[model samples]
Target: MTSRDTLAPVFRDVRAVVFDTDGVITDSARVHAAAWKTAFDAHLRAHPPRDPRLRRPFDVRDDYLRHVDGKSRLDGAAAFLRARGLDTPEETVRAVAADKERLFTERLRAHGVDAYPGTVRLVRTLRRAGIPRAAASASRHAGELLARAGVLDLFDVLVDGGEAARLGLPGKPRPDLFLEAARRLGVPAPRAAVVEDALAGVEAGRRGGFALVIGVDRTGVPDTRQRLLRHGADIVVCDLGELVVRGEPK
Candidate 1:
């Protein structure tokens, strides 16, 4: 390893790497955003009396990036609804979110989600390095996405929306999911690495006290990478391919 590699906390006590799905592994954020838009738009049309006051459907790309990209299903719904002046109860919103998930899954089955070779290569590198790996996501579709991406068996642990709700794990900015990931990997919180693309997720990593938090700037937009750092990421890169996880940087 080079000096830069030696300087990385992931090179020290890191026997594991925990990754976030959606923006991190696959290019399915667009797919999810589209599904969310469809569900929300239809729900609004069907229930005009609900608190939502929007004239048009939520924008899948921009709206999702702002409110729902890496958040839990119900949390995402609550956010968008609130944006439209709705204050539906958390539990009630959760039910709506579940319905939205059903729709999103249908879309996934039809179109399929694809993973980045760079991300798969990174996970493979960690596995070859004898380091455990896990996948964390606030989306309930994490399993389907990973399986469709053909990297389901790469992870020894999965802490996602379904599992989080089932286990009462806290969502982003609370760190429960990331913490559980480290525990499942048999790595102490301070010895594991976290890779995410959401501000909430980066905050989760910092709150969990992970060794390092690497943020992905997938949009290639200005200040997007910097926003991740401001949210508490230790390092931010445009892609996973930019970092050397198991060996010297190419």
Candidate 2:
């Protein structure tokens, strides 16, 4: 039960914690990015842009981080298309989004995502410490993903895309979903900590007035850690393992 001295300074007063799903808890961000690349590349190939500069395929890193990550399916589709200078009609956007959804679902079912061991360790520690935890995500497949990864039971509450739609909550960067999750845990926003990997999610947590915003940088991508800071992450860690309790094995 010995807590990490580094984390003690930040999480000591935290009453609850909310986590973002994809890159934060599970290794599903790459799956989603791959699906987006497939769908966007297909669309671009079929309708070659008039400008040669826009002829390149989707970038799983730059494009994903800037436009799609932490966004709703339709929003992500529209954002990426808009970035390519395409003002497509509603049907076209929906079609592209649907294609991505299908591809992601197929990959997820075929090759399920696994929970990050560091995240799992922290979750277990939180549970033992009597801290309530909630997992919130913009993906409709969040529940299925968590169940598949065998981490569904780790959370005291889950506020995912399906639930967001039912409640008509606004997507990330707006703070609705995270707020709802904190509410369900019976914790005030200012007393809860938010853990996220995406820029939008970090911004949302900041906007939600959470006590602490933890940014997770799995790979230390170029400027990613800095971007997270710019988006309002109070602290940044390359791995949740950095926050593990002192008595725990690294």
Candidate 3:
């Protein structure tokens, strides 16, 4: 049984939680980063940087965190290209994004994703406690990935890329996606919590006025926990398992 000593403090008033799909719940964030590296590196090699100073390969950690993580494919591609001083045409952006999509899909198919045991434990605890929960992401493949992980049924609501497009909601760092998920859960933003690993996602939760924003730092990167806090997370945890409460619910 899980110990209650490390239970997440936000659950005291947080009636619902909206979790980001990637690093927070599943172990697929690294895969996505790898795919991004492959696509971006190929593009960079084909169109070498005009400035030698900027003639560097795509950095999976720094570059992904800065421009790709938690963003739409096209947005990521455009941001990365601009960072490399190569803000090409819309067609070029679309092509790059398409290549990334293909690469990610192939990787996902070859090696399916797995839900983090810590996350699964916390989610089951939330379910047993009757706390409403939702899963939200900017990626169109969010739903597919969740389904493949076999944890799709754990969420009461899902506001993935499809729903965002249907509602024309803006992406993260803008609170629209999280706000929408909270609305669907019939809970006010201040009554819900957001669990995210992306800096943009934490900022979005803060902007949305959520009760608490928990940042999951799976990467164990230096200063990452502090970065998440600086970005807007009320508290940072290394794993969702830290939030699991054993024994009976109060």
Candidate 4:
């Protein structure tokens, strides 16, 4: 059994901490938002606003925050179009999503994903202290991103969308993917910690009853933190590296 005494602060019996990939570890949320906007705008522009262009195609800030983020590509595509009251064909939406993914992928091949230095430092601290760690992401490309970041070897377990779908694991806002990672890492739900930035991911952590749910408010906004708390994060931090103490051990 895990000992509460050792992991009782912001974390519980959590021997291994699980994190979301895109926003938590990497600085890719903005990239994703830009890609989504480019894809959705072209599609919506052609259709035009129902009310004489009263509204622009899509507001990346509000629209990304509301419908597309942290969701599966296909789901996101369908959702954005639905909100615009312009029902696009399934094939059309899928193609749009694929194009968006390609945009992201092209950017990746050119510049590649990079993990936050703070995240890297914190991971090292945890590893040095003998606390196992894992990662989970809604992206099927999570593995590829991690590889490009040169940190794929760090996590003991990884659960990405590709594996989740194959295993019949539910997506975010449901605890399945997080719980599945916990299972693979040999940790019980009550003894694990989950770290995420996405609203859906935080909600999933809440549903799973993880020992601790740490929300990363990278956007540095009160509303963002509030949203994370609404989904039930135990603690929210603007920076993950701040969690590391120079000479402390978990």
Candidate 5:
């Protein structure tokens, strides 16, 4: 375990924390990646790329991390399509995004997801310590996902994709969502910490000037850890349980 004093010194000054929902809190990122693969694969089959190098199918790991993860459905679709050198008209993007949404919803309804035990423990610890917590996600289904995982009540606030759109907040890699979550928690951005599993999310936390940007690397890949650090994560851990608050129960 990484003691707060050693690994998370900023926690002493952190007034609140904002977490990214999909991969950080709940195990739903893989579901989203699978859905994206199905949608993108179908689209690719119908419209193969002329370039041989770009003709390969979407890689759930690399493709999702680079182009789709932590982005809104439409934004993710457009980004992946562009990366594959496919035409990215608004209509095409929407069509692919819609297909992903349908597929994701079906999978979610069929097999509900669970919250990460470590994350739940961390959230509970923070709550017991009187620190406010917020869950922020690019997915509009964030709330539903949390509710299904039985961890929605753990957060004091949630800034989801629906709320972001309603407030005209831009997606990840922008500080809007994390900033809003901090704002709702009644804490200044510089006094709050942001926990995320996505590169874009860590970048947003850094751009927001949050006190700490903790990256959750569930993949356990050395390259992923380095990438997270390069993306502005102050520290990276494989699981939330590794983070131990000073004078707090293990």
Candidate 6:
């Protein structure tokens, strides 16, 4: 191993790396949040909350991270609705999720997302080091997102939401998706490292008994980093580049 790898010793034992697709690999989390906000705001307007505080609009940062990030559309919708004290009937949750999905799809097709340079660099470095890589996400559009960002070829395996659904795998905070990705890469959870931007994603990694859980906190908020740690992240970084060796070439 290189001297740089010694400094970040976690990589030495990691045989495979599983990455979360949205904020961790691509810049599409914000788009998802915006779409969620629009759908939720409309829902709230249509059916006003009884409590004044609950009437407040959805916060992309707080609400998204706490309730929706790393979760499936239906789960996310249900979580956020429950947080706001809204009725969470299955049909109601499905309706809101469908609306958010429509909005997100429209925005995505109109304006494609880009992969983070830092993440790409780290991925390439891992590849050069002969470590397998996987991209896993709760979004059904994960494959399209990666393809649009031109980085779909970087991963050795992709366990997207569609596959998860077909296989009856549960979403993040449950560890099924990441475990599946690692399994496809022929690596056990104990030998794989998981990189994630969502609280639930990191928790899943920890629960799955992964070798390392690196949290990406793009929010730039100190509390966000703390929250990630609290949620089971072994390490928290502002960007994936921080984990990259200084002299390593992309």
The candidate maximizing TM-score is: 6
| Candidate 2 global CA lDDT score | 0.92
| RMSD (CA, Å), each prediction | 4.0, 2.3, 2.2, 4.3, 3.0, 2.5
**Which segments of candidate 1 are over 4 A away from where they belong?**
1-13, 43-57, 90-92, 245-250
TM-score of each: 0.84, 0.95, 0.94, 0.89, 0.94, 0.96
* lDDT (Cα, tens digit) per residue for candidate 6, span 11-30: 88899999999999999999
lDDT of 1 at 46: 69
Single out the weakest 10-residue window by summed lDDT for candidate 4: 1-10
* Candidate 3 error regions (>4 Å): 1-7, 247-250
| Pairs with backbone N, CA or C atoms under 3 Å apart (clashes), candidate 3 | none
Candidate 3, residue 232: Cα displacement in angstroms equals: 0.4
lDDT measured at residue 187 in model 4 versus the true structure, 0 to 100? 86
Output the better candidate (1/6) by lDDT: 6
Model 6 Cα shift for residue 145 (angstroms):
0.5
Tell me, by lDDT, which candidate is best: 6
| Model 5, residue 247: C-alpha shift (Å) | 8.0
Candidate 5 lDDT for residue 46: 97
lDDT of 2 by residue, 133-219 (tens): 999999989999999999999999999999999999999899999999999999999999999998899999999999999999874
Task: Indicate the TM-score of model 3.
Answer: 0.94
Per-residue lDDT of candidate 1, residues 82-162 (tens digit):
777666797768777878778777888888988887787777767766889999998877998999989899999988888
| Model 3 per-residue lDDT tens digits across residues 36-109 | 89999899899988988777988878788878888888888999999999857999999999998899999999
The residue pairs in collision within model 1 are none
